[model samples]
Target: MAPVSLGVLASGRGSNLQSIIDACRRGDIKAEVKVVISDRQDAYALKRAEKHGIDAYYINIKDYQDKAAYETKIVELLRRYNVQLVCLAGYMRLVGPTVLNAFPWRIMNIHPSLLPSFPGLHAQKQALDCGVKVSGCTVHFVDEGMDSGPIILQACVPVYDDDTEDSLAERILEQEHKIYPRAVGLFAEGKLIVRGKKVFIREAGND
Candidate 1:
């Protein structure tokens, strides 16, 4: 099968984006990053995409009159690049309905803490504040709600009693890098099945 084409959106330093790129290059994922779009002009994610000779674009939200217009432009670019999958890697803004309707369950995101627990930013800090014994990373299908999507995969890490926010975040980030690529690989391989709020993983050659 041909490699799946991916469109990535990021707003900050894109460690997860880098992980995907490396995974594709290493043949660990049957996908290729066709284009990268960033809301911030100075996003390092753009630099990372350009470094790998991938098409990178900066779409300023201010340039568009409204959120819908902004996402329409994004959808245009994604379609132009024939992007089959959309990945949000450190993208700060909430995804509007325009984009959601355009891709449906084809969108994916990686969250720092186990989702439905600490979402909408500062997840590591939230875990520490809540005194959770285990914090983890989750890769899930994107939905209208904040990190409320159906989970595809997760990796857990023990929270140390003396762990600071950054310490916990670092451990979660390591897991994020691993599982995010694995989740994308599953999508590229047509091994993900979404039903209601649950995502089922199909075994190889089962279909």
Candidate 2:
């Protein structure tokens, strides 16, 4: 079978992007990163993609007249690459309706917190502030809302009494690297089924 082609959008250092790249190279995920797009020119994710000989692009929002135009350009690039899946690795922009309609449930994002709890930025800080005993990461299908998508997988870590935001984030990141790729692998294997707000995993060899 041909491997699933992935297009990653990122704005930061892209540790999650690196994890996906590494997983693909190790055959741990039946997918290949076709291209990477960043909104910032200096993002390290672009460099990571280029180092692996993958196509990388920087699409500045300032270059476009509106958010819709910017996302339309993104959709164009994804289609050009024949990308089968879209992954957001620390991408700082909310996906607009254009891209959402284009890909539907084909988009995936890895959030730093057990979502529906802390959805936006500084998730670790939010968990720490609330004095949550357990904090974790979530891999979910992307929707129009901010991290409000249905969950696919989650890995929990105990929040120590002395844990700072950075400490909790560091531990959660380790699990993020592990499960993000696994979620992608499941998608590649056609095991994900979305029903209403729930995602069901098909049993192996069922199809």
Candidate 3:
């Protein structure tokens, strides 16, 4: 089977992006990262993509007139790569209508918390502050709302009594690396079903 083409959006260190790349390299996922794009010019994600011979782009959001304009440019970039999937690997920005309409359920994001509980920034801190006994990561379909998308897969980790934000974040990140690729792999295999706000996974031979 031909590999699914992916367009990844990321900010910061992009450890999750590296995980996806590593999975592809090992044939663990039937997909190829066609492009890696970042709003910030200095994001290490671009460097990681370059190292893998994948096209990397730094599209400055400030160059555009508005959010719509920025997302329009991103839509064009995805078109250029014939991207089948748009994965958010630590991308801090919320996706607007332009890209959402273009990709619809095709976009995916992995968040640092179990979601519906802690949706926005500093999720690890939120979980820790809330004094939750269990906290982890979630891979979900991206939506217009902030991390209010349908959950795909999640991994739970215990919140130790002495755990700091940094320590909890580090552990959740490990689960992110595992499940994000698994979610992408499911998408590549045509095993995902998104109905309303729920996501259902089909058996391998069902399709």
Candidate 4:
């Protein structure tokens, strides 16, 4: 089967980007990251893509006149690469309607908290402050709202009594690394279904 082609958008160090790349390299997922796009000029995700021989481009949100124009460039990049999926890994910008409409359910994000709980920035700290005994990460479809889409998958991490925000963040991130890739793999493999604002994942076990 031909692998799903992906365009990853990230603004940070690309740890999740690297995780997907490593999964692709090991054949754990039947997909390839076709390109990396960043709004920031100095994002390290570009370097990671270049190292893997994938096309990397920076579409300056500052260069465009409005949000529509900025998203137009993003869509252009996806079309240029014939991308089948888009992944947001720490790509701090809020995606507008243009990009969401273009890809539909094809774009996804990994948020640091079990969404519907702490939905925006500083989610890790929010979880810690709320004193949740169990905190986790969520992978979900991206909509116009921030982290307010239907859930795809989640992996929980226990919040230790002595856990600090940073420490708990690191732990939840490890789970993100696992579930996010699995979510993408399921999508690429035709194993996921979305109906009536809920996702129904087909069980793969031989029960």
lDDT of 2 at 95: 91
**Per-residue lDDT of 127 in model 1:** 93
| Alpha-carbon RMSD of each model | 0.7, 0.8, 0.8, 1.8
Model 4 superposed RMSD (Cα):
1.8
Model 1: which residue pairs collide?
none
Q: What is the C-alpha lDDT profile of model 1 across 58-109, one tens digit per residue?
A: 9999998999999999999999999999999999999999999999999999
What lDDT tens digits, residue by residue, belong to model 2 across residues 123-185?
999999999999899999999999999899999989999999888999999999999999999
What digit string (tens of lDDT, one per residue) describes model 4 on residues 102-139? 89988999999888789999998898889999989999
For all candidates, the clash counts are 0, 0, 0, 0
Model 3 agreement with the true structure over 1-207: per-residue lDDT tens digits? 999999999998899999999999999999999999999999999999999999999999899999999999999999999999999998989999999999989999999999889999999999989999999999999999999999999999999999999999999999999999999999999999999999999996785
Q: Could you tell me how far off, in angstroms, the CA of residue 191 lies in candidate 2 after the best superposition?
A: 0.1
Candidate with more favorable, higher lDDT: 2 or 3? 2
The whole-model C-alpha lDDT of candidate 3 against the native structure comes to 0.95
The deviation in Å at residue 196 for candidate 2 is: 0.7
**Poorly placed runs, candidate 2 (over 4 Å):** none
